[model samples]
Target chain A: MTDTWLTSLITDTPQQGYELAITLSRRGVKYTQPDMDTLKKLRPEYANSAEGLTAASHVIAVNFQTVAAANNYWRG
Target chain B: MTDTWLTSLITDTPQQGYELAITLSRRGVKYTQPDMDTLKKLRPEYANSAEGLTAASHVIAVNFQTVAAANNYWRG
Candidate 1:
């Protein structure tokens, strides 16, 4: 389900996508906001997977580092 | 995964969470953007379910109607 959301965020449309990418760096999860252009260039495996997409619609679609950051950000 | 992101978006530490609520209204899927205050008062069962959240981190939590709108918006 999560993957579906991320993939949709990237694959559903090819125009200017709205993404939040904070992972590129630590642990847990990150809040990634990848733009449409960047989204187009990203590999499916790297960004969102088929199973993941099948699972849900909306997803964070980022590395754990960003997830943790976002969590911390919200907490703070 | 999708739900996790959204729940995090809401429950983790919601100050002013970012949500896209398109579901409450049509088909396919909707894009929703519900605010934090509202989120604080919403019932989790209705907003972000445990399974839904477990599925993904960034799911577009909305009624099917909003999903179609967002999809159309992105497609067009």
Candidate 2:
């Protein structure tokens, strides 16, 4: 099976997010982050760190599926 | 095979970033989002869009590997 990985920062309307999520699901991809509070609860260490705090403020809280995918996106 | 995905905002030293990258690589996780300029070059649409601009400023340009994994982390 093709590796399903993504590394794009998407910031748009809830509609857009929902649409993307749907697309991801159809492709066997999945959304990561839940609500903000829950994220904090999950990553307690990061939850208390500066990175965590910064992530919260900027909403940079999505992870990539694979390093190659992330590298490609980052390199592009 | 088990799916490998991520959905966490990581902000730390370049060392930490590198370390994480290495870990991801070993696990077959890839990193997306090249350098700022390159990213802009690749995603011109997002580059010109407000969301793209915002992502640039915040550095929230990573994708999730799997929905279940992302959901687990966010929920935790």
Candidate 3:
């Protein structure tokens, strides 16, 4: 939830870059919804349903696509 | 990059849920951009630039927000 979660996306290796991408995604969620209570409350509903889980994955893919594009597909 | 990357988002704990979210995001990118050569090639541009990194984070936040909402903020 801190602004400092990401200083730069420049990584020495692709593995590092990928890890950073995951961190960015996780931190993003924390920043957007700081309220732990709300997050915990809604967990069961989505966790129990296949549709909810798939929807979550779909969003992640969308975000990842943006990151990959920004990173130029991590091509060197 | 397999379709089986995510079968469900239901986790026993918040930690697990968060990890799953990260995996989903990472897998998403792989599924969308399967070309490692392209990803490596584009890494330097965004990796070295501040704007590119920040943009990546911004996209992550957006995606996380969507996931959070879908999970009802994970509120229990």
Winning model by TM-score: 3
Tens-digit per-residue lDDT, A1-76, candidate 3: 3355656656554344444555665566667888899878976564443333334445555644455445544444
Give the Å shift of residue A21 in candidate 2: 16
Residue A65 error for model 1, in Å? 5.5
Cα-based lDDT for every prediction: 0.28, 0.36, 0.52
lDDT of 2 by residue, A20-44 (tens): 4334532431235535675456654
What DockQ results for candidate 2? 0.07
Residue lDDT tens for model 1, A1-76: 1443232222121111212331122111223533556545643433233232322223322222233333332322
Superposition TM-score, candidate 1 onto the true structure: 0.19
Candidate 2 Cα errors over 4 Å, as ranges: A1-76, B1-5, B29-76
Question: TM-score for every candidate vs. truth?
Answer: 0.19, 0.20, 0.41
Candidate 2 per-residue lDDT over residues B1-76, each given as its tens digit = 2243433324234444544433432222111222345323344554456854564444322333222232333333
Best by lDDT: 3
What residue runs in model 1 are displaced by over 4 Å at the alpha carbon?
A1-18, A22-52, A55-71, B1-76
Per-residue lDDT of B32 in model 1? 22
Worst 10 residues of 3 chain A by lDDT: A47-56
Note the chain A TM-score of all models in turn: 0.20, 0.28, 0.64
TM-score of 2: 0.20
